[model samples]
Target chain A: MNCIPIMINGLPGNVARIMATSALRDERFSFVPFSLTGEEITQGEVSVDQTTVTLLKPSEREDKINDILGSYPGFICIDYTHPTAVNDNAKFYVAHKIPFVMGTTGGDRQDLERTVKNGSVPAVIAPNMAKQIVGLQAMLEYGANTFPGLFKGFSLQVTESHQQGKADTSGTAKALVACFNQLGTDFEISNIEKIRDPEIQKENLGVPEEYISGHGWHTYTLKAPDGSALFELKHNINGRQIYVSGTFDAVIFLKSKIDTNDFEQKLFTMIDVLTAGK
Target chain B: MNCIPIMINGLPGNVARIMATSALRDERFSFVPFSLTGEEITQGEVSVDQTTVTLLKPSEREDKINDILGSYPGFICIDYTHPTAVNDNAKFYVAHKIPFVMGTTGGDRQDLERTVKNGSVPAVIAPNMAKQIVGLQAMLEYGANTFPGLFKGFSLQVTESHQQGKADTSGTAKALVACFNQLGTDFEISNIEKIRDPEIQKENLGVPEEYISGHGWHTYTLKAPDGSALFELKHNINGRQIYVSGTFDAVIFLKSKIDTNDFEQKLFTMIDVLTAGK
Candidate 1:
């Protein structure tokens, strides 16, 4: 069987680079020699493992993608770009009929989904790509559906700690808030406590010294209205390596769907990839 | 029915004072004018909700107990004393045939339980008295039993934050750790991250400005072996009021149990009170 030709965008970004490196090392996929990067990135290329991939800025991508696509006609794109680029990047992938797996969060999510749903290619779009976290999410979704309003009259407080460089509240935390809301707490996504100070992370959150620049920690606390009880849920990620396997699995899952000619549904989620494996 | 006569101990301690004041306002229980304070207490008496209760230091308790017992014959004692006092207090209660409730944590827990079990007086003993938190505990206990080792191979991290003055890790957090262990992590109680510095609590844990001096926040995070997934549980308590209702309910529940001659079992827990309510 032919290995799926793959182009991983978001060059030089930690997560994208991890995925690009994993794709390069894995025997099942072929890593394309080109990457789509933000205009702000100054590097001409990024080295992943033993291979170096040319980085294309926004100005160069429009003209450069044509030749790259012409050479690798069956190329699949993996996007780990900025939140601001999500929708436009999806449109670009769909316009060129390139199937993709998007690991970025934010951008007009609804617009991105609509663009994919009406487009010619199928794509896996998820705020998170870790298969195990995706499985846990599926479990929470099941709980929300099976036991709606289970925590009625409970007060919810959310706290998330990420690397100091992350400028926004974690998308995973926001998604979990939605689940909690369905479980009966009146929670708003904006109410999430985002902790990014290095000192605070080390002293209060107990984040390790080595992972100070690369971690995601989140906590959700639910209290009974009368202050009689409390329930809490938390997840802490130490580094970017944890996400690689899931991202690669997503590529494999997307390829399988494409091969099966499941073209009617143009969009998929981490949930689809997770369940398909089971 | 006549009000159940009650003596609130641990005068001057914040928790004991809160309970004493609560008992004073409650109509179902008559507050006795006596308290068992630590040896360091120099005050003769402490005021609670317009009532003054004599404070008996450890040196005075034995000599004063006889006189107080004569005045309030059917008095029930509520202990919010020191960890060092738990075992001794239980012995005192058992020796005098005083049916009591012990709300304090620490001490030789097993010895204290055994004292109550073998002694003639019935007692309610619990590490935590928040009804809703107890309820959540019951649910977690259920999960542990029903799904043993459910989180096998998942890495677990426990973090707890309390007021700086707290001298020990939370007994509640310890109990929850046992629950998590049974639910499938090789966690040791000593491994829990205990946050007690005021600055760290406020800045890192996002504790409220007003609650720095009085809060109990706990978080438990579990991650899949490959770091692909994460799960978390958390409970954050502010102020002492949340525990008052559960403590009072325990008093009421103990009195009812005594009234029914259900004295065969001399020891009970918050779990009993919760389920009895249901």
Candidate 2:
């Protein structure tokens, strides 16, 4: 099998660095030396493993793309840039006809999808990139689709806890709350309990001392009207490794789709990547 | 295909009635017309969907078993009896050379397995029998086996809620705690929070009022030592229907094993029934 060339954006971001390190180690992928960085990043380049990746700021990307594409044509872009950069980066990928994977959250999501759906390139976009958690979400989605109103008259409670630095509620939790809503529970995404306090996380939620700075924990509970029955669902993640693993799977899946010229849909989510075979 | 004959014990009880009703509707199995009831019950018969099943008490069961066997010789027994009767019931089934599926909780579980392992009958025994919950448990078991100490230095908290009538902590909760332990979380079964208060279930947990008397809700939370990461798992069931579905599946699985004379391993759980083909 020929190795797929991947241009990983967000050079110095922790998640990007980790993914780049994985790409370097993976035999199926060849890492491109150029990255799309923000204007604020003063560094000219970032080193991942032994490779020095040149950081292409917003102003430099357009000028550099032609030269980079000339050398590593057909390379895919992996985005892990800031939330504000999500749409602009996507528009860039589409205008350049570069197939990409978007791992960044935020931006006007509908507009982001519309940009790809109307463009020439295909992309895999997902707020979460944890395979197992994605699989669980798929299962819940299955339940929601198969048993619509299954929890009719039932009440729902959703609570999510992430690292203190996480500024927004969990996207995965928001997605799952939609599933519960379809299952006939009246719940709002805004109602989801967001816990970011380290002291409360440690004392009340029993978070371990070593990992208070990095985890994703979510719980969704549903109960019958009479308090005669209750159902609770939870998923907790400790670190970034699971996300890295899922992002790579998305890359492999996107490459396969590109290889087969199966681009009729153009835009895909993690669910599509997850349930591709089954 | 020949229909498997099944004798469902603990008739007139809520779970057994539901299972019997399902068995009657299902064409894969023919329901035996007799049930082994507790000695406290004075009723000689119970009507299930127009089928008047004879109730055999302990004193009469010893003699009635021979006659019932004369009629339905290869029938399988489905046990949803009281906790105190779990071990003795298994012994009786073994002595009679009858296959069984035990869904009741609170017996000396190790001894219950030993009895079947030492006997001629193959049984599918599980504490909880909701197929989806069982599938989740199987997934956790896989993780535990594949990544021992994956959660090393993590703290764990287990909470379970059931009907007020339920006298013990959830068997499913206990089983999952064992799995989390294998994953390197230090948690004890005794530390599990047992929630049976209807007010708490409704007011605090948001359990619907109608199902406060008939539900199984469990949550398992694991956190890193430094409180940087967390993972939470939960399963909530509203009624007895899922258990009935799983019980029937177990019966089908056990019958298939018996038909092929695949009795090298005589003990089974809902997990085995679930993953039998996959």
Candidate 3:
């Protein structure tokens, strides 16, 4: 099997660094020795093991990308950039006919989908990369489709706890809320209880002290009107390993689709990856 | 309407006291002016506003119950006693033909149900009396009956935080686990994470200072096999108000059932009360 050459964006970000480390360890993938860094990053390069990856800021990417692509033709791009940069980065990839995997969330999601659909390049875009979580989501979607209004009269309460630096409610929690809504709940995305205080994470949420800076715990509760019955669901993630594994799987899946010339399915999601085997 | 006389047992216990206070404030029922106390109680009575309820120890209850029953014919009994006293207390109520509410959990639940089913007198039995939670359980039962194995490939993690004085896993959490099992997750009762240490409860579980002595926070998490999807449900109760209100509702429901000569349905649960109107 030929090694898949890939460029990992969002270097210096923790998630991006983790993904890059994982890809380096995998025998199937080879890094292109280039990364797209935030404009604020003063460092020209980032070190990974013994190899140093050259970092390109937005101002320098336009001039540098042509040379990088010329050196590693048909190479795939992996994005782990900020939510604000999702759309602009996708437009850049599409403008260059460079197929990519968008591992970042936020930015106008609808526009992200439209960019991939209308453009020549196909991409794998998902808010979440964990296969187990995506499989659960597929099941939820199944429930929503097969049993809509199943929890119509049930009252839902969503609570999520992450590292203190996370400024917003978990996008995964918000997506699950949408599934709940389709299953007959009237919950608003904004109603999610975001627990970002380290004290609360330790004292109230029962998060381990070591994982205080890198974990995600979410819970959704449904109660009856009379307060007699309750149905609860929850997920606790201790680290970024799950995301790393799933990101690799997405890369492999997207590569297979590209190899098969399946450009018609230009826009794909984690759900597609989850159900691909089935 | 005739005021139904009720004798709330377990005097000095916080839960029973809260129920007594609620009952005293409601005009629909009248107190029997008596309570059954544990043998350890040194006090002869407990005060509630202007009314003083005479406390009867285990030694006194056998003799006192006869006289009290003769005084207030067909009076209802509300038991909020120790787990050890559950079966014996039920035996006492059953032998005397005095219908009762078994609010306390633990101690051979199947035997308790059998006792109610075989006895001539009727009773309301439930592990949890919180109306909203009971209603949610009803919905869970509906889903379980309607969609068994709904979460087959899902992995479940149950975590519950309670007061340090609580020696066992929450009965409510255990009950919800049964629901999840029926819905397709293979989780054992012993697998539930019971949070008891005050430091852990305060630091990791986020129980409030005021409620550390009397709170129950339960979280149930389900994740797909590949870690791609997750669904969570949670319930955080600060105090016993929910249980108190639901206890009162159960009493009212039981009284109505007796009034209509519904002796055939002697074994009623919180679900019966929640769905009674529908």
Which residue ranges in model 3 land beyond 4 Å of their true spot?
Answer: A1-278, B70-73, B107-111, B141-149, B178-190
Model 2 Cα displacement at A109 (Å)? 3.4
Poorest stretch of ten by lDDT in candidate 3 chain A: A142-151
Q: Model 1 over residues A166-238: C-alpha lDDT tens digits?
A: 8977877877788888777898888899898999999998988988998888777787886645677767778
lDDT, residue B101, model 2: 94
How close to the true structure is residue A220 of candidate 1, measured as C-alpha lDDT? 76
Candidates' chain B TM-scores in the order shown: 0.87, 0.86, 0.86
With candidate 1 superimposed using the best TM-score fit, by how many Å does residue B13's alpha carbon deviate from the native? 2.4
In terms of TM-score, the best-performing candidate is 2
Best by DockQ: 2
DockQ of candidate 1 compared with the true complex: 0.13
For candidate 2, the per-residue lDDT at B39 reads: 91
Q: Give the least accurate 10-residue stretch of model 2 chain A, judged by summed lDDT.
A: A142-151
Ranking of predictions according to TM-score: 2, 1, 3
Error of 3 at A162 (Å): 19
Return the lDDT, model 2, position A52.
96
